[model samples]
Target: MRHAIGLKIGPVAFRVGSDWAGPIAALADLYRDYPPPTGVPDYTVRLEAARPWRRWIRPSVTVRGDHMLPDALPLDLAHGVLAAEIGMNLQLALGERRWLLLHASSVERDGRALIMSGESGSGKSTLAAVLATRGWRLMGDEFALIDLATGAARAFPRATSLKNGAIDEMLRHVPDARFGAALTGTPKGRLRHLRPDAQAIARMDAPAIPALILFPQFGRPEAAEAMGPAETFVRLTQASTNYVPLGRAGYDALTRLVTAVPTVAVDYPDTDTAVGMVEQLWAALP
Candidate 1:
């Protein structure tokens, strides 16, 4: 099949078309030991081998998709690689713009960014949906790119993946919310997309200043609390998997982040209280 590569990810431009040869040529760029120029790829590889060695990829090499196969595949198997590919590229692309990718959920309000970061099943996605339904702009439900130099946050617009009763709970509160394309039976369970704000969706590549860095822990009801910027920064940096990968560049970036942004921790039970609590925290930001 012939395909056109439209996305520029890191140093590689993904050129896939209707032709099977499209992926073949794109993968060829992955063979090189040095990072190629803008259009030329550094190396390429087969689809099956993607997950294990993805971390070894360097700007020095361009990875092409040489799997020469149809897009049709089992939903569960396909989602993992797809997520890995998308996540890797998202991290690289935003890094070029000086953003540090944080494994967190982020939403926006009145032009400022509020981040909900935590381990899996920590209720970050649920909180994001609540904020979205309550009139806050949904930046992303999974990954948040924080500009280390400026303490600004950018959107990584994608479907919010909710699981179990979380979906029903969201529907109860936000009957009008739009769910994106369904991707089911994955490792993370059946996943679906939450409709993103059209305007926020359009500005996915744009960055907004960080107003609040929140570490959300959803459970028994409690008053919303604030965490010191220093503590918040420590936790955020610790929670990150790539912060150390960036080394000195990473440290400089993270320091700038806590110094300029107000980092906090929030805990609550239901969506109503969580939304109100987040609002109070944001209201105090400049």
Candidate 2:
């Protein structure tokens, strides 16, 4: 690897090295505010050419790291930044055991956290980005870290990956300097990474009490339904990346979360309605 960059996002630290300078430069710019790892990084991601000769040819990047999928495919050099980001996420998904990792986006207000999880088009990431711009503190966009013992939501404020229309939507509220270059023709379609607000980066270490859990569904007629503990438990277990790996500890942590937090399933037609729905739900929380 010729170029390398180290970044710390909340509790997780990552060292990413690349055979080409492009990926490293992109990461350095995107993660400019994040500090390097204090000691050793929690994970290391290496981006190398698929073959030695391929380095200067029509280059493609192979994502190799501490943890990887057996048959993971290589990505074009143009998408090297995405490959590095995915590599870091893969390491945590397959290796982390320190906290109960939820495939959710989270934000905080008044020391309380609101967690939102859903499928690919859930709009949770966009909602989180908007909320952070509004008044809530963006804790995380990809994975919401929940303490096993304390049940608090720890901040993991990485750059928000906004896709398609979501990108245009965020550009309206967030400043131009806060966004990364647009990348097109990726697995997730055209996307851009939005740097979290200054406040989110500054307060990335703060932890908030788990106050609400939401399963948000976009493009639906507006509706909000209460979710029972059993349903919430089942949904979260499926959403977690390492629930089974943590064994009984994971079970207990999730149980505590489901029981203590008010869970709801909400459907909205657009971002504004979705935001209103979240606000209403939060206001109604006891």
Candidate 3:
């Protein structure tokens, strides 16, 4: 708990403390553009050594804080930045109750939002990043927050985690983007972090009305199918980490979202084609 930093990303604030300086420094560099969080943070994440000797010899970092997994494994110090990121995700996923959390990515155009939800390898993150470059505001990465009081899509544009090939793809398009070092041998494999565009950071607090929802799947022939409310509701509930915890408020909010917004499932063979499909879909929205 020696080296630490506070971050304000949209509706959430995080205070991450580390036993070593490297992780904190790395995180600070990645989130340099963000404003320092004021007042008490919504969640606290701690990076600690397994034992006293571990800090000095063969250093390792264990994620701990307000909410923790009982059997979470330790991560090598070399991947401390990832550890910190994972720690923040843990706290947010487990502790957040203010907004209805969806494991999705989002972008905005013309003051309305486009949310893409899918499982790992679905290309949602890459799609969001690509869309951000093609004239869409990056509203969020990894999670999409829906305000319970108002059925609006709040921006939570944290640094986007680009894995393996994604790192190269993003680098090519976002030439001036600031990126964290590629950390190899992690569970998800050679992942790097990309800071959100300046526009995303500057408008972190802005909220957009949800206009479209797309479930994108990668490695398939291009196709699009509309998802009925029943299926969309189930899929969204599965994606949300805090749906059940929010109870009736969560139910009402999600129902409003599903009924008011149309949902689609799209398949694409690559990023370029995916972008085209998304734009076409966006244009078709009524």
Candidate 4:
């Protein structure tokens, strides 16, 4: 193995190159821990054959092996370690800045922002793609980093993972949208990386203070109902990757965000309805 890149995510650092360097270094920087005390990443990966674009096994990890094969090992072993690393980095980078990585899908229009948080298979990414195609700038999908002090949200503009029916669902809206090859047999079914809007890619690492925290749950019929601040706070913490890991820093950031911003809950049946609800939310922003 050749050490092609070097990075530091808080306390942990990595030296790897070529085939595994980019993803490994990123994993180390983003998550910050390895599998157990061995300090080796524990995860299998499927690369996009481009620059810095990949889908993570919910928890990703690196290990000592002659081959980086995806199907050879237990998924749990890798997921645990890699997820820890990504979670750690998320806490360090965002938490230090008093930001929380709200587990949500976020997009921006004009100057307003809407964050849609939900579990996997909730069509968050599909909605994000729809908004981006309709000219709403993509802020982030999967994670929305909210700046506590300024009430802004940052963008972690990685590839949008589309799975199962979502691939065709988004293609209908974004006919020209580019995508990486499909990766199968992992967690989210058959998944592909949807390229972000070019401008959003340029501002991938940028952060913005939020105006609204909308928790999205795609249901039978499209609808959005605003939740109280207190309920939003609990959900925010639960949605975070490193809320508890950063201890005081994470807690303080979440408190500041919930207090300063108007948090709400939303539900929509399909991508179109979700995007419409988001647009409404943005229009109502002050």
Candidate achieving the largest lDDT: 3
Each model's lDDT: 0.59, 0.91, 0.92, 0.59
RMSD of 1: 9.0
TM-score of each: 0.69, 0.98, 0.98, 0.68
Model 3 Cα displacement at 120 (Å)? 1.0
Which whole-number lDDT from 0 to 100 does residue 246 have in model 3?
99
Q: State the displacement of the C-alpha of residue 260, model 1, in Å, after optimal TM-score superposition.
A: 2.7
The residue-by-residue lDDT of candidate 4 on 1-286, one tens digit each, is 3333333321233333333344444444332322222355322223222222322334333332222333433333223323222333343334343455677778876566767787887777788878788887787677776664565677765557678788888778765337655556555466666767666755544555567777677766766676777887788888886687667777788887777778667777777777677777777777
lDDT of 1 by residue, 1-286 (tens): 2323333322233433322232333223221222223555322322332344532332111223433223423222334333434433443433334557778888886677888889887799889887777787778877677666666777865546677667777778654336534456655676554555555455565667777788887786665566776787788786665687677777787777777677766778877787788878777776
The alpha-carbon deviation from the true structure for residue 40 of candidate 4, after best TM-score superposition, in angstroms, is 19
Q: Return model 4's CA RMSD, one decimal.
A: 9.1
Error (Å) of candidate 2 at residue 39 is: 1.4
Off by over 4 Å in 4: 3-98
Higher-lDDT candidate of 1 and 4? 1
* Model 1: residues with Cα > 4 Å off, grouped in runs: 1-97, 173-177, 181-184
Better of 1 and 3 by TM-score: 3
Candidate 2: regions farther than 4 A off: none
